[model samples]
Target: MKYTHTMPFGAAVHDNGVRFTFWAPDTALIALERNGLAAAPMTRDADGWHRLDVPDARAGDRYQFRLPDGHLVPDPASRSNPDDVHAASEVVDPQAYDWKDAEWRGRPWTEAVIYELHIGTFTPEGTFVAAQRRLADLVALGITVIEILPVADFPGARGWGYDGVLLFAPTAPYGTPDELKALVDAAHGLGLMVLMDVVYNHFGPEGNYLHAGSPSFFNAAHQTPWGSAINYDGDSSRTVRDFFVHNALYWVEEFRCDGLRMDAVHAIRDDSSPDIVEEICAALRDGPGRERQIHIVLENDANGAHYLERGADGRPLTATAQWNDDLHHAAHVLVTGDTDGYYADYADDPVAQFGLALAQGFVYQGQASVFRDGEHRGEKSDQLPLAAFVSFLQTHDQVGNRAFGDRIDALADPAPLRAAYACLLLSPHAPMLFMGEEYAASTPFLYFCDFGPELAAAVSDGRRAEFGKFAAFGDEAARARIPDPNAASTFEASKLKWEEREQSPHREFMAHIAQLLAIRHRALVPRLAGQPRGGRHWRDGEALRVEWPLANGATLQLLAHFGTQKASGIRQLAGQAIYTDGITTDLNDTLSMAPGSVCITLQEDNTHG
Candidate 1:
């Protein structure tokens, strides 16, 4: 089957010829330059858009726009940039690739066990084809969804995709657009849903030519950490908003992606009634979402829960769910006892907060955050479904943002970390794993990027300097020990050593996780839809208790003791034991949960009988 999203922007290939659409509202003069050949003058309409109808132009042709200043710039809406961001844009026929997963309707959000990965660091080849070859491995690990880091074309040979500058085109460093499509097709055939990460908050520091053509794309009044926030609500912002809305659609329809996970949405500054996020979700729900399950998750640090509100029909009003940073933060504090930056917010009694997260979604829930200087954070999330929050022990931000990018395995004891893993995966919340987490790989997921010499040095120096507040990196010599992000070795060090899975400790951990996922798929997954909201979580000191009512009139119970010693006076839980880790015993009608242990049981509601 064939799929194509018809957007007003970008080059559209017709049977007769190609029709080019360029939106440079501020520019008066422009022309189309194809294949480094003679330039063809374009006609500018009243809205500052230029159009060029070329009868001979066809797919696979390279093109760029010539500004009035005599400078050439690639199209912002390019489908594929084979050469790189600074080079020519390739005209791609989205309908050319024949999709084999035409019948892939997609799995429900309740079934999501997200496995987030960076394409460049996921496999040795760091290409789409290599990643495709590893799809069955993820499926074998029981990952229902694969969330890819942003693939939008960015400058340089290697980097985390968050720095992507091109909003539409897939990076050339990965395979061609067709190869990417094949990967998505292969994933769907394996019952895996692929989700792309998109950044609409701010463009990268390099290779953004919109200012040279469409100067109004950035709003000067609102600033972000990356720079000026995107012009989402200012004057001439309709076209800017359309650019991103169509981007979401293009990925789902043209690329046949299952959905998107918008990066750092809290950084986006949009003041309109129906915000950009809402508009994007509405577009999807009205468009392709009507047919298949197309999810829109978010990485909003602000902890906004309103966006995850469901309609009267129990369908998501806007976003499907958001990354539950609160859960990760609490788990980190509880396991590693690391109180730095945002982790400081969860330092005091993190076990209670962790329980709240497992039972009631986000723990903050409109509470004052100490790390935010007494500022209130998050909305009430107790009423939301457990699956509305994507839970994880680690993410790109959780690990990569660190000074050394140490995984949780390197931070805490093996027993506590094992218990934490059980807490994360066995919970009703949608769980996600950073690449290679299932195997307990020893590699660190460091922050690495390749930029020009000037920007590269600045980024490297700034990266080392940012950890100055930490006592470990207070000295200049100590700070210098941090790996340089621009170094090729740094990027190579972040790649997963796939063969490590056959080793002793790694193989043992992999088997444990596989067993947990097997039980989850057999017991929890089929009954997830019955859970309308989060469960009840309470804790007495380090001993935590959580319970959820499932569809079969069974109460799923979890008893965990995070203390260094055994905890007594625990009420005995009745039901079939689903899984157990560590030493848990029952004596004289009382339960004694050993230190760093977790127990899962199901109590069927058959007392009346």
Candidate 2:
């Protein structure tokens, strides 16, 4: 039998039926204020867990927590349903959803070219089924996986999925439970892996109801910019951690998802003996003896390698992958040269950006950061494989955080932007792209949400005023102009024009991305398959060269030019121009590199021959 952690017991949903549970360690009496059903008294267990089995409770149920004083609210441990965000939770029959990916094992992190996208804005329709229609486009572009932004139920049909309140439900605005399954099935049919991003940091301020029942799911010990930190190591913390771990496993097993990207793990604080992260990792590593390889990525700026390291038992724990923010910062600072905000720390050091991102994981390793005020340390990545870092030129936070909801195109020259693109994809690390970035879509990805009047005002006025206080990050005066969540235009401005791919410049850029992806797949993928571990080499700023040397004489050099200015040198490869980017193939012997192009070929002519 598989070992299960005993939670403080807020709520339980098994295959048979849901045993409504709660850990009110401090409560004298707890009642259930269920929606669509009559209120009932819950029986308290000796361990402070309240239990009331509802056999008739099938899928599509909406419920919440009720206090003894007649105070009614949503469930603190709601698998779904909070503030009517995405509708009520359903008792989904996991077995009913047929998965066609039975032959679809999994893709290694090293070989993955993840495309991070928000479902709502990915297409004109902005629905799960609508997004599924584009699966062929991603597959044709040589993308192996789609890392979706947080899809857990959040308030309204708009907004970034981060402020999710319902921990266990997929966002209803996207689609129904069956529709999500269909989307996953469609992706698998195209040989694409699907990764769902999940947030366990802190509940959004609008629909948080843990205070109504088990109020200890938060800690006053430390604070984060969003809200109070999660109760990872606080009183009755075991249950809180269990709640999240179960949610994570449910997505993997129940949804049959290929992987999960844990959002903002840095916000989780745990000084306990057996760390919450460790516990979660162990649960994932169960079943088959490590060959299954269900990927679990983390988004942390801590620059710690141990987070992805294995335990003494040979079980991987830290994370399979993480967002390489340093790479983004370096690339952004060099190409755009925007010397405001947090980027102030990275101005005038583009080569440093390239070198650090090449040799180590982050450029801010062990350096005194003026923005941070203290010396920040990063893990030594010399022995680590390059795939440990997942890089991108643009992401939701990097673009949406701007006061005006601007993208890189707003401030960067197209030529240099192309150069940055080559640098990102051709680098040793795994590369990711935001939606519509390949064709240089002009629409801005803004921050929008639908909340109650008071919360909406607090978010628009208060959040904007607070973020604007960081004059070091951007123009303080323009902060007031940040897109308001209440405005319909905010959501409309973020949608992608699906038809633009057929246009002139957009078509050309799209072709460039497709060519780049092919080269990476043909030249770089095999090296990882043989070596499993990744490798790289550094070159002058004029040209960045990465060599992945394998067991045999098999080796590959991912060559890319950094500057947008036309570059030419006589000696690199005399006759082969089979795979090239940003450069025109005049003939077999001569090559003219456009601003942001790259070439992938055998390290030596003899290898190809």
Candidate 3:
């Protein structure tokens, strides 16, 4: 049933039927075209909205909108697209699906273990229903939340959902609305929270007809890689903001999505005029289901706390979580010792990297960025709960954006990889694992797009040009690095081999992740309580140690050795050896980490026993 814009969008199905109302101001005419029923043109109200009181429209009947040109299209505001990816939208009766999660309390950000995955490459079937069956596996793995990549309809049936054109419609390839619901239900049953990634920064190049209808949806004042930035502060922004707000609510209320991990929030350029994010948050929290909690996570490079701040009214409008790139950079540089691109600012100082990330939010806070040559900085994480900083050594972007999707497992020495994993997972920040990383899957996460030959060529060329701004690779090398976006082999090679979990080093890595997860669950549980109680000590050029104190009065100390070779000058404290990779402490009670080796706790009291 269509609900007017002035009136909050609500639905109720009676024996007589449902009444649908839509707000389309730019349209010359609007019609409600139901399946197998005579078409009825909706009369426009004073506010430019059209309302059709459909007495015959059943709860589950399919419908579409007939534009002024007699061109029928799927409803842009449709709650559910039931006819699969490329078919007509259905009139979803939101109450039709029986939700067993009435008593299902939502998970807090502090307790969240987010698993980011691409739907296309997540499983063998590569569909929502197929992914649903594996929720138990995630639940078994001690994952509290599953963050699915962007699902908005992109160009083809198979693609990374970030390049979406149909922002309103869920990708037809993922599954039907009911199927999505089933997946969410399954996740809920498994006690796993679901966070769907939503892209609002810019629309893809193709299938974006929003401009043809209304150019005001974007503004030229800000340009982004994807396209013109969204018209967040420009003309007709109220309606634009409403559109995205509705999209956010649709996922949570209709599809049972628990949260939204907003992709590239930094790209969402908005002026001082009518704070966009605040309004969006207001719209989501204003609905009938007042008591239900919905989480919002943002991916930003700035590491600014402004996005996490409340409104003038003191309302908590901050994102529930944000990706901590500093943590990734520190771990990447410390473990790999590769100082190319942004990594230039972050090598030879694991203590500085680890301590600052644990203390301040970013390592290069207010420092001149070697890559950009400008001042780049971040907020201090000391005031924020450790969980607020989402830590990950490897994510899809880190791996897939590379010349090849080479994971840490592909590196020569497994010891450094293992040490890096230990440092990342055992740290104070909330940890995230890339798919197949737990098992050290050897398959690469190559960049695969579903574009045709022409677009594929453009993508390859564009990728090389973009990376050329930072690194100097030959044209042939760059082109060779760009996988054919349209090739089936590209996507095929990206899939994780679940069977690898049983293999040699894969099994060993899995054991490590499992054990680390257990330790995190037991010791780190209290850190999720929104209290940031962590201590750190770092010598500017030598060593840095960060400590997370547990409720049991025990401490989880992370000592990082920055030198390439083991430093044996510091004193050694004799304690029950918990973890070490042939790395020992120095003469002055300082641990000499062998290049990438991480030594755990050491106390003289334990040695006396």
Candidate 4:
């Protein structure tokens, strides 16, 4: 089987020829420049689209567009740009590659144990082919989904891929477009689903020539952290909205991606009804989702509970789930005790906050956030199912954006981190791990990027300045110790030392995780299909308690102690103890929870039996 996502714009190959189309409403004259053929003038329509037809164009042919002023730019919807984002685009026949996993419809959202990874650093080779070799390991580790960082072509040799300019093209440094498809196909063949991370919030500051060609692509009325906001609801914004919506479809349909995890959607300021996000989700739901379980997850800081609404059948109406920052922030405070920045909100009572997250999804449901200057954040999330929130101890942003780029294992005690991991994987919520979290790999996921000299120094200096807010980096000398973002060593230092996984603590952690996942699949996942909601939670001294009602009339309870001192009066509840990690009970049936220990019990409804 072969797949190709035909788009309205860009180079589309047909029997007649390759029809090269460009959206340049601002420019009046346009030309197509190929390797062998002379620059041919393109006919412009009233809507600002330029079109040209070449009968001899074939796959692997390099072509670029020439503006009225003779400036050349790569296609915005390019499928592959071998040279880079700034160079010519290679005409790709997506159907050229035979897809192996045609029968892979995708796993249900409830079965998701997402492992978010960066293609550039997932393996030693940092290419699609190299990353494909590691899928069997993840499958053995019980990961259902592999969420890769943005592969859309961004400028420079190294990047996080969030600043991508060409939204449709796969980055050249990571290998060819067919190689990416192969990676996805290999993952599906291994019974694992692949999810691509897409950024619609803002294009990278550099190598984006949309403003030069399509000046109306942005709205000046609204400003974002990264310049003007994308023109989703403004005048001439229809095409802009279509561009992103099509990009989402392209990944799922053409690349055969299981789903897409949209990055920082809160930054996408749109005022239209059924806004850009809704439109994209609707398109996915009606498009590829009609045949398969194509999921859409969001990293929305806005805490938009409405977007996570489920239908009568308990499937998502729009987004499948959201990255639960509330859960991470609460757990981070309990683990690291660093109550600075946004962690300050959870610092007051992290255990309670963590309990709230476990029971009700969001802790700050319409409550005043001290970190946000007394502003009320989040909506009522008690009604949402536990699976609607994707919980994790570490993510790329949580780890990489830190001053030292320390993993949870590095900052907190092994016992606490282990307890957190148990809580993360054992719960009803979907759990995600950073690339190396399974084995607790030793390398730091530092924020590294390669920009031109003009922006390189400013970016390096700004990275240092951002850390100045922390008390540890009080002085310039301390701040200077922070790695340079643009340095080659910084990117190299961030790669996972795979050899360390076979070492002492890492191997133990990996075994522990595998055990937890085994229990989760055996005990919990079977109960998730009936729609389980987060239950009640309360604090008993230093012990945090939470109970969730499962779909099969089972009450799943968790008793965890995060304090340095041992927590007493953790009553041994009337249930079958499924998992006990460093938790003990006295002879008198009085329970004692050691610091950084967890105990999980399940009470089946015997009343009906």
Question: How would you encode candidate 2's per-residue C-alpha lDDT over 225-341 as one tens digit per residue?
Answer: 756678889877877787888777777765667778888777677887677776776677673215445877788877777776644543345567778888788788877877666
TM-score of each: 0.98, 0.88, 0.86, 0.98
Model 2 TM-score (2 dp): 0.88
Task: List candidate 2 segments past 4 Å from native.
Answer: 1-18, 33-37, 82-90, 287-291, 310-317, 466-480, 530-554, 558-560, 563-601, 604-609
Worst 10 residues of 1 by lDDT: 581-590
Off by over 4 Å in 1: 540-542, 584-586, 606-609
Candidate 4 lDDT, 516-607, residue by residue in tens:
99898888888788665667899777788888988768788898888888777667766888899877778878888888889898888877
Look at candidate 2 and tell me the lDDT of residue 25: 71
Question: Candidate 1 has what TM-score?
Answer: 0.98
lDDT of each: 0.89, 0.71, 0.68, 0.89
Which is better, 2 or 4, measured by TM-score? 4
Candidate 1 backbone collisions, by pair: none
Tell me the tens digit of each residue's lDDT in model 1 across 399-514. Answer: 99988889888898777788888888888889999998898889999999989999999999998888988899889999988999999999999999999999988999999999
Root-mean-square deviation of every model: 1.5, 4.1, 4.5, 1.2
